[model samples]
Target: MAALAHRLEDDDHLSDADFIKISNLIGQQVGIKLPPSKRLMVEGRLRRRLRALDLASFSDYGDYLFRLDGLETEITYLINAVTTNKTDFFREPEHFELMQKKLVAELIAQRRDRLPLLKVWSAASSTGAEAYTAAMVLADMVAQRRDFRFAVLGTDISTDVLDIGRRAIYPAEQVVPMPPGMQSRHLMQARRPGARPEVRIVPELRRLVRFDQLNLMDESYPYDRDVDIILLRNVLIYFEKADQAKVISRLVGHLRPGGYLLLGHSESMIGTSITMRQVAPAVFQKT
Candidate 1:
């Protein structure tokens, strides 16, 4: 252990060859592109894994990662370490506005007869913010229409983020982006003495949303085909165009005809091959 610690102290940086291997493996497993520009960022993130595993260097970590037995157990930790999970309550306010003003009513009217329950999928939900935001919006709608009912599914490649989502606890400041009154209605504060300032989503709202581990690069997802709305936002920028299109096409298969697909503002140009018409900026509907 002393020698291993000395070796780790001597080799602190990720080697170029090891970085390339890691970048390629990440791309293959999760459809994320990690170019040379991100080498430092990758090294910074993976350092946590090295510390966790007590590995001597990036090369040592790489050896364990590529081995079949180690790969099976370490893949989740690797993805969790490197994946970017920037999220906040109501990150894009306009998307929620559109949901409340137009989409929900239309979806409910369209499926009222056969399927009364509206299903929403947050395809790249990071820490449950987007999914919980959607739930808060839909839950508000239920007050106006007694027949309205909904379910939200939040999926991400990082199990770490999903676990955070499932817990529904966040720092108190993270709720600032949420509209007035919504916070009071949906969040419970942790006010005990010496407790850090934090808030948890109310039980009622948490009940309406569920988080799951999912990789968009997989050939198929285990979800229902009649989803009413799918939010694949802010994540496609990490992929190559081909992978982006493939992911969009696969997600479209899960939506019902007339269901909506919401993308990040920058991702509007891709997914042209799919039979979906643009309904709003970064929003599309199946034809």
Candidate 2:
């Protein structure tokens, strides 16, 4: 058995061909094209996956992933583990400013069930700040009205972050950079007082948002695009152009005619999409 395993180890590292296979699988499966710049990152994250499965080397693990009888569950971990998820309350503040200052005014008047409800979708809402920010905006909208219905939906590929999102608990440090008014209105410092200091969204605002796990690469995947606003921020940098087109097209199909799409400042629709028109820096509208 020891000799058999030694043979499977075959060398200390995966070959270049093996790395390409892994890259193709990620691109084909998750819509994320891993550039050569990510070589070190891939090796670091997948090394754990290899050892966890008792595989001796990455080559063995690659074969195991593609085997006809193998379970595909680990593939998700492969995607989630590699994706960057840096975000916070209004990381790109201008987009949210547009939603509050412009988009809401254009929405038909709020009238109970018939009220022009605001639905904001945070497409790559990792951890939860973006989603919660949307919820806070809508709740403030409601507080000004006699009656209204508003919803914020946040989706991501990370099961781990989805769990945190649903719980709506955040460390106090995560919120320190937010402005005083927002920090006070939407959050409450937790009771723990000392150790790391926790903070959580206030109950009323917490009730307005929901979270789910979604993969942009799933062809049959559907997004609830009937929203007043959609925030697909800071996430498209991982996808190549074709994948971006496919995901953007599908996402736009769900938007209400006058709805807005907000991309990361560094992200853009490129030349492939005709469904939206540029409205401002990092903002687009589908009409």
What's each prediction's clash count?
0, 2
State how far residue 227 of model 2 sits from its true place (Å): 1.8
Candidate 2 local lDDT, 144-214, one digit each (tens): 86355788888998887888888888888888767788788988886657767888888888787888889
Tell me which residue pairs clash in candidate 1: none
Model 1: lDDT to the true structure = 0.88
Give per-residue CA lDDT, model 1, range 1-287, as digits (tens): 99997676556887777788789989999999999999888888888788899987777887787743587888789899899998888887888899989998888888747548899999999999999999999988887777778999999999899999999999887898887788988999776824558889999999989998999999999999999999999999999988988899999999999899999887777645557888888889997
- Model 2 scores worst on lDDT over the 10 consecutive residues at 107-116
Give each model's whole-structure lDDT: 0.88, 0.77
User: For candidate 1, what is the TM-score?
Assistant: 0.93
The local lDDT score (0 to 100) that residue 281 gets in candidate 2 is 81
Badly placed stretches (over 4 Å) of model 2 are: 1-13, 50-60, 67-71, 109-114, 223-225, 269-273
